[model samples]
Target: MDLAVAHILSRVDVQGADVLLIDGPSGAGKSTLADAIVENWPAAEKPTLIRMDDIYPGWGGLAAAGEHVRTRVLEPRSLNQNARWQRHDWTLDAPAEWHDVPSALPLLVEGCGVLTRASAALATVTVWLDADDAVRKERALARDDGAFDAHWDDWDQQFARFVRDEDPVSSAKLVLRAS
Candidate 1:
């Protein structure tokens, strides 16, 4: 996996195309690859990791506000009106960000729906990782520490819906398997 990444990096000599998206299903090692790639890149070209989760408001954040708009609301409304929509809140009731999207570029968006039509249209390259369902479930379980069984189940369902609705894998530039 590491060597594969190195090969891709070496061959992709696009100057100033700093953004390289890493996308995949849950537990497909998007984070693992992102970390390794950034770590492996030269200091001048080292990529800064921008997790979609960080840009998003967590359950705790939205639970309290109830009706508040997310910080990222304006960015999408003005940037693109058709982004894939996802908004949720917790007991705190704060409103999480949502978008339904249009193409935007020069930045790598790594996560479940990062490679969808909106992103892929603008991306220079997208890395899609794959693993068997059993492996994916096992990795997901280990990563969540058994604390989000119900949430995980719900997430799985959501991922299915997202994939069915927007098949990002077909558009990826590269398909990789973590194991």
Candidate 2:
């Protein structure tokens, strides 16, 4: 791993009460960075993950159908350190029981739409990871099992809209070079 990059990343100070946003195109190692931060940083200083999907119903959802349109954002009061939530199972399309999601003092809301409208302006620190389109596709494909042709195609379209809105380089406090 890149120890230098990890050290640099650890130094970022969140601007305010809001947690940091790791904004990057898909497959730019968003979760990988979060995992690294958790692993490498001193336990006290490590930023725990507050996954955007964890706040939602399932793993692969921004919003479900008309009934549940980003419910967590609508009720931001419950999202404190003592938040009680059970993330939806996107693949199953079923609601789960309420579980306590301790609000980690320094959290990483890492994902594509994380930098989009819902959570964008609330970010304390916005770190954007830069990589070209081809590289992104390759990385994503590798992560999605062997060859994820259809997944990559759909992702390309979705990501275009997502990136258009976020434009992380323009939006983030710091744009980090991603390998």
Candidate 3:
């Protein structure tokens, strides 16, 4: 973990990356890594963080969330345009309020579907994280308590399809192991 954090910080320092995308399978610690980066960010003005988890409309929205991040967020931001994205209200299972993102601030997006080819092109840095299936499943279940219990198999299926179709790992500039 420390080495990963140091490597990310070094990337930011050397590359002057303004948009960092951390992506991987669920329970691979993408969110935890994002938190660490933000906490230790060198810049006084921290990057704005967005999680794909918030964009997923439901259990099967992995692909949709990835597209949304590419088109609505990364593309616009790359062109120096303000962007807005709608969040999925998980409890209500509906689209929620829009969140505005300015291109002026640095951005950090982290979650399961974030490292697609198109999205990677827009990001200044892209990371792929992974872990053994058993470890990942255990961590994911514990992290979400019982909310994700019923959807485990279904979500894993969707993720598998995403991996096969998008091959997001190929788009990553940096790859890390979570456990």
Say which candidate scores most in lDDT: 3
Q: What residue runs in model 2 are displaced by over 4 Å at the alpha carbon?
A: 1-18, 43-45, 53-60, 63-86, 97-99, 146-148
Q: Model 2 compared with the native: what TM-score?
A: 0.70
User: Where is the poorest 10-residue window by lDDT in model 2?
Assistant: 65-74
Candidate 2 C-alpha error for residue 30, in Å: 1.1
* The 10-residue segment with the lowest total lDDT in model 1: 62-71
How good is model 3 by TM-score? 0.96
Per residue, candidate 1 scores C-alpha lDDT tens digits across 1-179 of 67866865774543444446666767888878777766666546454454554333452331111112112322343345433434444334344555433323223456665556555555567778878888888887798777545666666776676667667688778888877
What lDDT is reached at residue 17 by model 2?
A: 33
| Best of the candidates, TM-score | 3
148: Cα error in model 1, Å: 2.7
Per-residue lDDT tens digits for candidate 3, residues 67-178, read 9988999898877787989999999999999999867777899998888888888888889999999999999999996999999999999998888988989999898888
In terms of lDDT, model 1 sits at 0.57
* lDDT of every predicted structure (CA atoms): 0.57, 0.57, 0.88
Better of 2 and 3 by lDDT: 3
